[model samples]
Target chain A: MKEKRLISRRRAIFTGLTSAGALLLSGCLKKAPPTYGSILRLGDDLTYLAQRGLLSQRALVMEYQQTDITSFPVTDIGDPANPASTKAYSKEYEALLKTDFKDWALTIEGAVAKPGKYTLDQLQKLGERTQITRHSCEEGWSAIAEWTGVPLAALLKDAGVLASARYVSFYGFDKYAESIDMLDALHPQTILAHRMNGESIPARNGAPLRLRVETQVGYKSVKYVQRIVVAEQFVDPAQDIQAGWSWYNGI
Target chain B: MSASQTTHSETFRHKGWVKSAHFVITFAFLALLVSGYVILMSHPRLYWGKAGNDLTPALFELPISKNYHHGGWAKAIPFKNLKGSQVSAARTFDIFNENGWGRSTHFLAAWFLIITGLLYLLAGIFSGHFRRDLAPGRGEFSLKMLWRDLVAHFRKQSSAPGKYGLLQKVTYLSVIFFLFPVVILTGFAMSPAIAANYPFLLIIFFGHQSARTIHFFAAVLLLLFLLVHVVMVIRTGFKRNLWAITFGK
Candidate 1:
């Protein structure tokens, strides 16, 4: 009797699998084509924005100064190091170090024709320009950070961007993985930022290297980037291969 | 068949982890609620998108006949009038900012939930949570299952209990996919670097301000769902249903 009861219970569990709802929702087994695509697909719009456009993009990033170095809003995703997450006032500028970022290099490689690295000096050697760009974030707040970095085009030009280089994506060490497209990559305000608040980029704030893509939003400005790969196509292993992030995240 | 059935200790199940994750999320959520309430006491019934009030207390005699800093509430706690810089206002903001840490704690607990939920989801899938709805001996579909569940639910009968119903599956799947992702994305949409890095995300709901409004709304929805979920669990024979979730191996 116990065994029979268990078997009946088991049968009851998947009771929905055969329901009209599942049959209707699961598009895999149907012969008739879907009248509408999955609503899941629209969720990819932000991913799409992060992936395309150029030339038409604008120069809207802002700039900040040392004296104007006020409080950057405290992030809710507390640093893994300090889980207690003391308020901004209790925040310490612990990663403070003074170094001329002259030797730093921004490497734009992967799926590119001329995969090469450019030093801050070499990048400046290519041609230098600075802009006060607005930093828009998905977080719904905006701040102006004065950034001094090399032009993205200078690096793109050096890479000779292989014919297939479709997406100029960002690489960061923020423990976050985000990217952008060629349009914003080559935007005038878009830069490989080396300085913030008139000083070298601090480690906590994507130091050693960070991109200042001012037009679209902040997440596109990959920080703590050890390298940038100009892919023949925008390929996010974390997105397509892993848990999907929208291919384009332009807002 | 009897021998195939594994003993309790032998099989890895949610016996331990689910309980732990539940406790952590609950604890962190509680902390956030408490901190937020105290801080909001500084500014009762705050508004979104529009300008709102931030009331301060004035020092005076006991019974504390209070005055609204800007507006009034039907029945709000009043404090006596006071003199001097209102240190409590600053303290309130401090705690409000501090509550942001509760979000971090929630995420940490979320990490635990994702790990455990992953196991449950995977095991449920591979172990045929999807297939259990099908009859074991059949190559053909059964309309009987549907008729029975519909009848039972309509008549408010509890005899049809097995694991989860069709509606349960729908709700669970929606929560797992749509609702949860909305919460996560909206949460990220509030970061400065993130906002700067991905302004397009801000553009999705028109701007960051709107995204935040949506995030708050989603939280309220999740809270409502949680309340309903608890009630349903109790309605569906709390201990028996819980035994499956907690100790079923």
Candidate 2:
């Protein structure tokens, strides 16, 4: 009787392991967002789906008052103190910085009916919005700051976005790039920020232009933006994915 | 012979589903703790309120690594009302920053833990396991009984085989009902997306940083509970306990 029981127990364990493996394999079969591995990507997909289902598309993130604004620190990767680490910044950026971006122009191209370059002065003339919102980083730190800029949707409309456009990609002068879905691109809070805290954005804080995706993590707000591309397909920022960062960091 | 048969029959204490959930959550918890530590090593400082960073004053700091104030604290400017407590943005040393895998593992493990925990909770309730096995029975909550259990534990006297003592029941109940829920809620509060949808989480926790601080403490408590639980299992009868929970023998 004891031998029979032991054999049955071994069979039960085998069956349990097999079923668990099958379940995991099924999860792997589903297409997921870009992450480090299939398992991690599956987890990201679950989070993305759950958040998308629960959160309102138009719901705004929390906004604080001027008094609530705190000391916003620049990320180490973009630290002006370590210019060598800022791989995207080049000699061209240095020249533009010397003239305070006077010669700089933001190019809007790809999937746009009227692809054109707009100087800083002309871009600001399109529209303007200011908001005090918290910039939450994935590293468990956050800061609140007031940002002033023109809404990205305004820029896209001005460029006459084509019907084929599905994603908006932002490219920095330093070669860093990031993209957002049309939902976030059209978000009222999403803007191409030019000024921070009532002053021209400091060089340490992405200077003349940066994308402010208030609803997502701070990293999604790519700084030093020089070009905007409306894309017909999902534009994957290869660097971020290669570094194992989640493509859709909604939170 | 009759007494031996009765004891043998009672050896199978755990239900099949309970054993499965227990093992799954155990694996997930282990993954979470290790990955959580790796993530924390990247930035070991804790703060209060909505915003905190290298340029802000930290409410609490851990010296696990050189990440804290590597460039030295900022000098106080009396006119500016600065207290010189903020960490300087310039760092003398590079921060520990290999947390990409850690984060992915943490999120993945968290999903497993939540699913398994929810299943265990629903099953425990429906199956009367919480009432019949986990809950303190009549007279079990009495001070005398609790004290007796505590004294017996200190003396390393094993409780009855296949039965939980008063102290065990209370600890299990608190862990299941209070501690796990608090930890999960505080975790959600830290997520910006979740907070955007559920602002009440932020309001309850006082802010993002506060939620992080609370999450850290709750995790520590859970760690302590795990240690004590493993010790108790070993002290009682490692083989018997393992067999009962694993094969439900």
Whole-structure CA lDDT of model 1 = 0.48
Candidate 2 residues A20-133, lDDT tens each? 989875664343445545666667667766676668878777788767777766553543324575554467777889887889999999999999999999999999999988
Best by DockQ: 2
User: How would you class the docking of model 2?
Assistant: acceptable
The positional error of residue A70 in candidate 1, measured at the CA in angstroms, is 4.8
Question: Which portions of model 1 miss their true places by more than 4 Å?
Answer: A1-38, A46-55, A59-70, A74-104, A173-176, A240-244, B1-249
Q: Candidate 1 iRMS, in Å?
A: 12.1
Q: By lDDT, who's the top model here?
A: 2
Candidate 1 lDDT over A46-137, as tens digits, reads: 22322232223553432433332222332222231233544321122223223334444666778667777776667667766665444543
Docking verdict class for candidate 1: incorrect
Tens-digit lDDT string for candidate 2 (B1-249): 124323433453799999999999999999999988887777788988887876777998887665755654324222122232222233335567766667767888999999999999999999999999998877668888888999987866656666787888889888999888988998888776777778888888888888888889999999999999997676555677788889854
Q: What lDDT does candidate 2 reach at residue A156?
A: 93
**In candidate 2, residue B127 scores what lDDT?**
96
